[model samples]
Target: MDKLTIALPKGRLFDPVVEILREAGVVNRELDDDSRKLILEDEQLEIDFLLSKAVDVHTYVEHGVADLGVVGKDVLLEAGASVYEVLDLELGSCRLVVAIPEEAGITSLEELPSTGRVATKYVNVAQEFFDQQGIQTEIVKLNGSIEMAPLVGLSDMIVDISSTGRTLRENNLIEIAEIARSSARLITNRVSYKTQHQRIKNIIDDVKAVISKQ
Candidate 1:
């Protein structure tokens, strides 16, 4: 069997994903979140794990650097990368939403200026969503702190992933619309899925079984 490489996102989803892998008997050693190592191997399972930023998981899998990856649906939608999303792990649940300042007096997309500025880390997702709604807006790509955009006059609104509405409320932002619900998913490289069918199937089945028990 060819050695399988799996990519795990390093954030809120990390610990849960590691626990699932352990339950599926795919990982033998304890994974230290504080470890500096980017790669970990389990000889018994013939697997190598790559810890990466959530946004980079798709890139690693799409480039075939890793055979499998655990990432959020939000990243997948934003990236639009060519990778086979095989299963929803049901972890890291969140929503992609459009938000505006509480005092903006914009209760709906239609209330905003015909041409406005939107800020987000998810540029692609934001563009697609607004374009589909026939709303023309300039997208400001921000790597972090999207909430500050509207507050500081950088943008009129923002598209961001929200697990809870707490952050938005605290920042005096209101969710104007929900673009999509997001959860962690199991994705595989297209070629790897075809070339390592049985092995990959076994791993998927193990994960499904564990999820079923939960």
Candidate 2:
């Protein structure tokens, strides 16, 4: 029997998703996040687990290396990958927002200068949001330390993720606008959906039952 492969993101959402797979009877073994093994196979259940960085999950799925991928909604929007975004797992919820230094006090984005500079890893999403709002800003792409950009005067604003707002507050920044609310999502490769319809549908149904109870 061919093993069904599911790609799971390596960071925050991994353990809970692994637990969900267990509860759904898709896999019968406990997978360790701390383990060095990136790929784990469950012989009894005929399933393969592909553990990878959160950002690359979409790429794996798009290329059919993974039949299905569990990743964040932000990743899908940022990567703009061609895959079926089949379900939202409702795990690791967060918001992508437009944030400016707290010292530049005002309640709304409108109160800020129309032309400013923004920093973020989400270039495409941020560009679209600002354009829609008629705000013209130079966007700088940063891989990390997005909050520090505004504090250090590298940019006047930042488009980044805020989970509890604690990080922004601690860094003396305030969220001016929310671009999107995101959570973990289930995505499937186009070809895999057609080739492994029954197997994939069964798992989706099983996972849905677990989520519906919540």
Candidate 3:
């Protein structure tokens, strides 16, 4: 009957996850992120939330700093963190794609050269993907503004997550390859999963129930 600490990504996925938590009866009151506080507590429920960047959720759970976490599949792939993926929240749905500038005249992954430069924050994903296709690419890691790389000739293409094609269309980028689909995932610390089995399972069931209705 101990308190459980959960790591939640603090970005676009935050609101949706919070809504699920509320609907699942994990928290009694409405949760708000527009605050200076990094941790939010629900004393009655014996739950504490660690609000963090999307990329660090897996790390915290893997290190046991958090018993559970909500993160994206893209981050889990890029970070290669060791944690049990308990459930797919299915929020923040998107796709990881390889895109090239419209002027490149490349219509598919087959049309691209054997060796080229790719700009992406997901270096591991990009490397693994191209290697599987028998193509070699120099992955340039850029934290943000990945679309700008191809426009300025910094890279031949980009491996990025695109929720909608609008951003790519605005930047004149066309997706030629889809590496993977991504969504919010629930992950648990290995040891914690066993040590706090029922408590964790209760929340998982609650969340799953809420998600099934959506």
Candidate 4:
């Protein structure tokens, strides 16, 4: 029998993904998040779980290295990976927002210059959002700590994911616009969906049943 390969993001969504898999009766052992092992297996259910960085989950699924992935919707939009979004796990909820320094005095995107510099890890998402708003801006991609961009004069503003708005507040930045709301989603590779139809459907149905009860 062919085993199902599942990729799970290593951050906030990890615990929830584990819970879902346990509820689905596919995970029988305790998962150790701090372990050096990246790949885990459940021989009884013929499942392999690949633990990966949040930003790389989509890539793993898209390249067919993993049949399914659990990742935040924000990462999905930022990557724009070609994959089937099969289900919303409704976990790790957050919002993507455009923020500027508290003293910037810019209440909206319109108040900024026609072409301003914006820093973010989500370059694609920022570009698309600004384009749709008819705003032109230079997008500077950063790997982490986007809030420091405006503080250190690196950029005019930033687009980043905010779960509690605490980080923005700590950095003395205020949100000017909401880009999108995000949550964990179950995504599948197209080819894997076709080749492992029954196995995937059974897992999906099990997850759906768990969701319905929540």
Worst 10 residues of 4 by lDDT: 26-35
**Residue pairs of candidate 2 with colliding backbone atoms:** none
Q: Which ten residues in a row have the lowest lDDT in candidate 2?
A: 105-114
lDDT of 4 at 151: 87
**Model 3 lDDT tens row, 1-214:** 6889899888788898988988988877556666678888889888888888888999999999999999999999888889999899989899999999999899999999999999999999999999999998899999999999999889999999999889999999999999999999999999999999999998899999999999
Model 3 lDDT at residue 98: 96
List TM-scores for all candidates, in order. 0.96, 0.96, 0.96, 0.94
What Cα-based lDDT does every candidate model obtain? 0.92, 0.90, 0.92, 0.90
Q: lDDT tens string, model 1, 1-214?
A: 7899999999778899999988988778878656799998888878999999888999999999999999889989988989999999988899999999999888887787778899999999999999998889899999898999999999999999998899999999999899999999999999999999899999999999999998
* Candidate 4 residue-wise lDDT, 31-96, digit = tens: 866769999888887888898998899999999999999988998998889999999999988999
lDDT of candidate 1 at residue 111, scale 0 to 100: 81
Candidate 1, lDDT over the whole model: 0.92
Clashes of each: 0, 0, 0, 0
- Candidate 3: the clashing residue pairs are none
Off by over 4 Å in 1: none
